[model samples]
Target chain A: MPRYALLVEYDGAPFVGWQRQASGLSVQQVLEDAGASLNGGVPAPTMASGRTDAGVHAEGQVVQIDIALGLSPERLRDALNFHGRPHPVSVVKAAHAPAGWSARFSCTGRGYRYRILNRRARPALQAGRVWHVQGPLDAEVMHRAAQHLLGRHDFSAFRAAACQAKDALRTLDRLDVERQDDEILVRTEARSFLHHQVRNMVGTLVQVGLGRRPVEWPRQLLDGRDRTLAGQNAPAEGLTFLFARYPEGLDWR
Target chain B: MPRYALLVEYDGAPFVGWQRQASGLSVQQVLEDAGASLNGGVPAPTMASGRTDAGVHAEGQVVQIDIALGLSPERLRDALNFHGRPHPVSVVKAAHAPAGWSARFSCTGRGYRYRILNRRARPALQAGRVWHVQGPLDAEVMHRAAQHLLGRHDFSAFRAAACQAKDALRTLDRLDVERQDDEILVRTEARSFLHHQVRNMVGTLVQVGLGRRPVEWPRQLLDGRDRTLAGQNAPAEGLTFLFARYPEGLDWR
Candidate 1:
């Protein structure tokens, strides 16, 4: 069996999430079914670098799968995209990873972006893709507050109650906030994140942007390490999984 | 009767076009219905800065409507937006122009933008909002070619066969091409345009971008002044009516 890495992009509005669920459709099930049919009905399970919740989009999600039937990278990508039809999911790229390199285990870093439509008027173009904040948001203040979230810490304050991470400890490499015209973009990079962590952090920063909290609130929350003292999770629609980075020898493409 | 001016924005995927037609629904019909309902069942005819074809978006379209019942600018916008619920259309701003000024006649300049998804993968995020071009497009070449289209010309080569413009002569103020990441944006500004002029120009520029046509091809087409001498019209989905400028002291806000 040969293992391949796929860079997947999707609009999350139609999906239940990245994982297969008994309730509704998922990106994983669609790809696996496409692969199974393409491989003559042999079961093909895909392991993603991470899973995004319902209504969470992805620009560059990584997935690794071992197929019994070998196909060229271009043919495999085209076949999967062809079968995925009308569904908003797309396999943007496919490359052979090093043998035994798993998308999840071999990932070195992951990046996410959250888009905020900070304007009085509602979004006509990016209606469901952005979090529409009617009130003016101070992006500079939000950026100043977000800087305190950098480095390793026990991010229990920003962790979801249902998070399955064994420990609250994680290293956050970067958290940047910028105002692009009417959009407030928040970008974050880290080795890993607890469930709903990115959305939680953004939600907390939104408070600071609104002048409801001081600039040092996020830092204080990090120091407190108490989940009950944090802000609500930002809606999943605004979040996008940007990319997952792998080690040097993994043949990432 | 008091008239009001509206700065409109919309995703044009839903309606037939900006004008009412017996063939299908249009943005004008919906806006009229919404306005009629909002104004005690009285018909409110809206005169827009210009009409867009089906699937053509608008970011700053101007429209003027007269109603028997008087309403402040604030109430007018809120009421129109309220009645236009569930539709992608939005009245982003409302103001009162000079008493005799019309949305169409008062316009001094108009701007349009065309977006091309220049990538191998089809657009997952901007589906139906962009023209997906799988082949590589050289933005610099496109820009070089577009320079020839600026300043003034008889744009018959880029006009639609069914265009009703009195003359093909028009002055183009600006034509710009820029690449932003995987997207190619073409912006054009002019006093007015012939039917399908923007889309036709973009399609011709696309040929130049792909190296199928010379950089001076557009200038040659202008010299020929023949409709059949140019490339096909680009899809309406990619073009957006960006803005319509009016004269001073009319309360544009």
Candidate 2:
């Protein structure tokens, strides 16, 4: 058996999430089925770096899979992409991985991007791809407010109730809010995130941007250490799993 | 009647192009209905700078509409966007035009952008928004070939049989092809274009990029003036109406 690392991209609107679930179709099932088609009809399981919520897209999701057949990386990618046809999922790249490597445990950092269409009109081409927020929003204020969550902290305010993580302490590497034309983009990177942490932070920052809350709002929520005292979770459609960074010298493009 | 100029944007996947036809829903009809919603029961008519083909999107399409009510430009824009809900069309901006100004006649230049996803894997997020070319495409050679089609020429080789223009002679101001990662962007600007001109040129450029045709192929096509000898018309979904440039002084922001 050969282990391979795959870089996947997908429009999450069609899948339940990145993981396999009993409820409905998932990105994992689609990839596994594609792998099985090439592996003598034998099941091939896959593991991803993280699990995204439904309707949350991914630009560069890393996954690991084991296959019975030894195929070239390019061939494997092409075959998987062909089998994944009619579905909005693509295998961007494939490479042979070291025997002991893992997609989940070896990942060093993860990045996410959230888009808000901050204009009076609803979106057209970007309808399902962005959060359409009407009225004025000050990105500078949001950026100022986002800095409060930068360093190591107990992020219970931004954690979801359903989050199963044992500890609430994590170091936030970056959180940037910027406006381009009629859009407000929220980008964040960290070693890991609690369930819905990025969405909750964005939702809270939006309140600060709209002048509904002061710039110190996020700091207050962090100090309170209460999820109920924080802002609402931003819609899932606005979020995108940007990328997962691995340590240097991985030898995979 | 107060004549207004509207800056419109839309996802053309669901509509029958920008004109109102007998077959299906159109962007024009959607705008007219949105306009009529605010103008009592009277039907509002509109004229556009250009008529886009089916599945052709728009970023800054300019249209002229006559409304009976005396409302501020922002108010009119908000109202139209409100009524256009559930549809993919949006009025980005609205402003009062000069008494005799026309969106079509007053336009001095038109621009279009064509996107090609040149990769082995099919598109995931940009499915309908780009032309996915599975294999290699030399964008540098394509850019070299595109230059041969610039300047004034008889473009019968690129014009559709159904083109209503009386003459096939037109000035092509710009045609630049460049690649950013796996995507090839073909951008063009001209005083006007014949039916299917931009798409045909892109299709021909792809042929040149794929090594199927020489870099001077477009020059030969230009000289021969034979549409049947040229490459196919690139799909409409890959084309976007970028903008319509007007004369120096215009109050519409």
Candidate 3:
């Protein structure tokens, strides 16, 4: 079997997250079905760098697929796109993966962007693509508070109760917030994250931005290590998986 | 009756344009219905700065309405938005309009923006919001070619046959083309325009960007004054009514 690394993008409103399940359609099922069209009805097995939750979008999700069909990178992308028509999913690029390269383990970093339409009126142009907040939020305050969680720490307060990761300790590489017009953007990167860590942090930072919590609240939440002490998880629609950063010398095209 | 000016924004995907017609829902009908909800049962009449075609969006469309209610500007905006729930239309701001003020005859200019997604893969996040062009485009060349359409001229070549304007002569204030990443933006402003003028000009400029038309083709098309000689009209989904410029003294809030 030949292994290929595919760069995928999708509007996650119609999906049941990135994994395949028995109940509903998922991004994984769409790609596997598209792959089976080229591989004589046999579904191609795939593994993604991260399993995003439902209603979470992606601009540069990395997925590795093993299939029997041999084709050029461009043809593989075009074929999958052709079979995946009418679905809001696209294969932006595809490349041959090394014999031992794994999409989940070979990636060193991951980036995400969370969007909030901070306005009194409901979203019109950006409906479903952003989280709408009615009250005014101070982006500078949120940015200052976000810096407290940048270094390594035990993020048990931010992790989900159903998180399967045995370790609560993870090093966060970046966490930045900025406001543009009526939208506030929260950008972050990390090696790996426990379930709902990024969204939990965003919810807590929003509290600081709204003046309900102080700048040191994030640090206090870290020290408390109590999930009940943290703010609720932000909605999934605002989060987008930006990219998976791999080691140098890997061909992404 | 109290007259008010409203700065409105809408997705435009679900409505049959900004004007009221015998069939289908229009943005005008939605506003009138919302007004009637506040009024004693009679619908409030409204007029817009421009009558956009079906599927054309707006960021800052201006409208004037006359209603029996004497609510304050802030309360009026909140009331209309509350009644307009579940629809993608929103009134961002509202202010008192003078007795003689008219939205259609507003004493200034109008601006529009057309977005093009220049990429090989089909759009996922921006499916209905942009015009997708698979071929490569040279933005610099397109920008250079767009300058030919500036200034005053008889724009018959870019006008639709059904355009009811008595004269083809008009002054074009601005026409600019720029590319940001994989998207190309065409921005234009004028006191007024013939029907389908912006879309026709965008289509012709795209030809030049794709290397199918010469740089001087726009000049030749303008000089010819034949509508059939110009490129096809671009799709309505890619066009957005950006703003309606009023005199400096009028309070838009």
Candidate 4:
């Protein structure tokens, strides 16, 4: 069987996230179903770098699949996109990966971006693509506070109640907050994270941005290891899985 | 009557341009109806700086209206936004303007942006928000060619068949083309424009960008002063009305 890596992009508004479930449609199911059709109706399993929650978008998600089809990289991408019609899910690029490379295991880093539309009135031009934060928010404060969250730490306070990760310890690589006009973006990267960590951290930092909480709040919450200390969960719509960074030797087209 | 200047933002997908039409809804009609509801069923006449075509978006459109209702700037902006719901229109801000200031007549300049998604695959994140052009585009060539259309010139070659302007002569203040990643953005500014002028000019430049036409083609098209010499009129979805600049003394909130 030939293995191919797909660089995926999707608007997660209508999806149940990256993994397939009995309840609703997922990005994995859409790609696998399309892959099945392309492979003479044979079911082909697809694996993603990470599982995203419902209504979470992705700009550069990496997915690996094994199939018996004799299709080229470009043709397979086009076929999947054609069969995935009307679903907001799209395969941006496809490439052949080495025989033993797995999308998740080979990935050294994962990046995500959280967008907030900060203004007095609700967002109009960027309606679904951003989180609408009413009133003023100081991005500099949020950026300063976010630096405390870098490095190795136990993120049990930020983990979701339903998280299944066996360990809550993870190393965060990058966390930066920047503002442009009425939009504030929080970009983050890590080797891995427990479920709901990004949103919980962002929600907590937003409180700092609003001046309701001081800059020292995030570190205190981290030390306390209490979930109740965090702020809102931040909505799922504002989050996007940016890219999965692989090791240098592997080529990802 | 209280006169207010409004900074408006809207998604043009569901509108029949900014003017009221017999067959469908318009941004102007929605604002007038919302104003009427707040003014005890009395119609409020509203004027806009520029009338956008259907499916053309706006980030910072300007409008002026006279209403009999006694309301502050904040309240009026909130009321309009609240009543305009279930629609993709929003009044970003409202402010008290000079008694005789007209949104259309008192404007010093207008800016517009045209976006093109330059890639082999169709856009999933920006589906209806951009013009999807497959293959490569030389934005540098397009920028150089666009310079020929700037300054005061007879724009008959770019004007629409149904354009009602008395003369084809207009001064183009700015025109620039730039590319970022797989997107090409064309920004333009002038005191005003003839109907479909911007889109037509963009379509011709796209030809130059695709290497189908030479960089000097725009200059020849301009000298010909014939509409038939230009390329296809670019689609309405790619265009956005950015802003309308007024005189320095009038405060536009």
| Residues A38-93 of candidate 1: C-alpha lDDT, one tens digit per residue | 66697578999988999999999999877777888877888888877878888888
> DockQ winner among the candidates?
2
* Cα lDDT tens digits for candidate 2, B1-253: 8999999999999998999999999999999998997678676889999899999999989999999999888898888988888899989888898868899999999999999999888899998999989769999999999888889999999999999999999999999999999899999999999999999999999999999999999999989999998898999999999999888545654
Candidate 3 local lDDT, B1-253, one digit each (tens): 8899999999888989999988799999999999996678888899999899999999999999888988888888888899888899999889999768899896489999999999888999888889999899898898888898889999999999999999999788888999998899999999998999999999999999999999999889999999999987999999999999877535755
In model 1, the Cα lDDT at residue B193 comes to 94
Relative to the real complex, the DockQ score for model 2 comes to 0.82
Task: Give the range of the ten consecutive residues with the poorest summed lDDT in model 3 chain B.
Answer: B244-253
Better of 1 and 4 by DockQ: 4
Tell me how far the alpha carbon of residue B8 in candidate 3 is from the true structure, in angstroms, after superposition. Answer: 1.2
Report the number of backbone clashes for model 4.
Answer: 0
- Candidate 1 vs candidate 2, TM-score winner: 2
* Steric clash pairs (candidate 1): none
How high is each candidate's TM-score? 0.94, 0.97, 0.98, 0.97
Candidate 2 A-chain TM?
0.97
